[model samples]
Target: MANNPCIIIADDHPLFRSALCGTLQRELNEPQLIEAADFNSLQTAVEAHKTANLILLDLHMPGAEGFSALVFLTAHYAHIPVMVVSAMEEPDIIRRAMDHGACGFLPKSASIEDMTAALTAALAGNLWLPAGIDDTPAANEAELNIAESLARLTPQQFRVAAMVNQGLLNKQIAYELNVTEATIKAHMTEIFRKLGVHSRTQAVLAMAQLAINPNSTLEAFRSQALPLQ
Candidate 1:
């Protein structure tokens, strides 16, 4: 596989991963294939193999609560193309994955031919979706806005926000992130300002809203008492 592209198959199911690997081996020209069963390992693999050409990500894998892993990857590793391969094929899910910067979406049930085609297109810098699936109905303006705001966050601030969502206290987050409590507080303040929130609770709530229903409109989000600030 020397000098060939490196592709990651990030899925928790061992059987599915094996099948996908077999298909890739058959379809591709002996590309370097890396396998990860969870989001943490996926991140580590990506970091170690900076030349990776593509990532086949699963939406519900361990350590990837909802679209958070996708969001984190797109935010931090924007250069590597990601193609989501998930069992969930709902249009809304597909649309959201695309919105979060996935280059393509392949349902787990797709045939080997379709998988090959999708992966080829994504590697060539083209977006791919299943046939008959409308690519319109893009993520609502509110969702887009939120994504843009989140993208503005520094990497450390982004990590802090995720910890906040996990209900970690400021001190706990500080210890885990290996920063002083005051440094954590300063990061939280900036995070709140960037996210348009006044308090930690409001900041957490805002992130929760996006996580829960990223496709919802501003009005719908407000209805849940998640008004900006």
Candidate 2:
């Protein structure tokens, strides 16, 4: 890590973030810390600090879906490492997070020692997972394909697709992203092409394949839009 390595703590809960921040400060000797209370801020932080050394993410941020943000971060910022520090510490969620691309998973309840160790390991280009979690039943071929397809999207396209997955219309997406509807429409077209989907609904369905819902391979299946074949 650099002498003043930058780390982004991307979690929404204020108290938990504070506690984690304190632990990192104590353990890391106050490395440059950036706090983001939501996913949009996370994006802004990453964009502003492209040379960041590590990102500690929470899966349930305001604008993020479980595992989806991890996928986006890992995809868009392949040079920087991401470690999940989430309250959803079940083995299944942890395993899914790893499958989607996070280099480490530290449950919120983990000891400060373990948390600091996780952050350090990820910065060192290593994988650090929770102890005693069985690593089995890895992500399936379809899920892998879905993740790869999503990795094809640019950072801006990923943001547009995330909003579309939330069921937002183009104009509303434009308003939120503060771009013209025509600009958003052009982005949607590229998103659809890269995702191999034909329409907004299909684009959402394609990105939803990377979400936390294990059951809604149904939507992807029905839409037949993923082009993972």
Candidate 3:
């Protein structure tokens, strides 16, 4: 069906890529598919095929991480929605991708029905997060008060908070920030207290929303915000 929508599939694994393409072809019937085996291939494909309606991306490619790719596409081509198709079940990664503007995510073990449903939901303009992952960016209360809370953090803490907001686990944050996991955990606890949040999801939602509208001054926020010890 030449009239059907077009999608680009970017995955490193041949078997999964082939299987996913086969399933999509069978189910979608008419949607055109462009396959990319790696990040370079995906970059090239994205440049050449600007008409793609959606992108199905794998997270752990060797050269370029899936998150970066998501950022690139969403920033450069804001009109095209990107969905993550990955095996990673980590809550933080899932949450991070959503914050970075992924339209949805499907685990590698997802059933055929689930995959089709997620894709359909995304195409319909819905954010495709898993059942319990809570893709609702507006559902968290902390997110509603981001501007006030970010001011409570010190410059270093702000850096840590940014990584945390990006969905990095404690260990990953530690590695990225050149600190121990324990340090990251401590910073997170302090962040939660300052932000009046209890969980990672809450912190993420709040921070992501703050990034969207960063009008408040960090110093002005510090003067009025309650101290968190």
lDDT on C-alpha atoms for all candidate structures: 0.79, 0.80, 0.70
TM-score, ranked from best to worst: 2, 1, 3
The worst-scoring run of ten residues by lDDT in candidate 3 lies at 210-219
lDDT, candidate 1, 130-184, per-residue tens: 9877667566676666667777887678777777766688899889878899999
Candidates arranged by lDDT, highest first: 2, 1, 3
Tens digit of per-residue lDDT, candidate 2, span 14-83? 8888887787777784588899997788999999999988999988877765577888888889888889
User: Runs in model 1 with CA error above 4 Å?
Assistant: 1-3, 61-65, 212-229
Which stretches of candidate 2 lie above 4 Å from their native place? Answer: 1-3, 134-137, 216-229
Which stretches of candidate 3 lie above 4 Å from their native place? 1-3, 136-229
Tell me each candidate's TM-score.
0.81, 0.87, 0.58
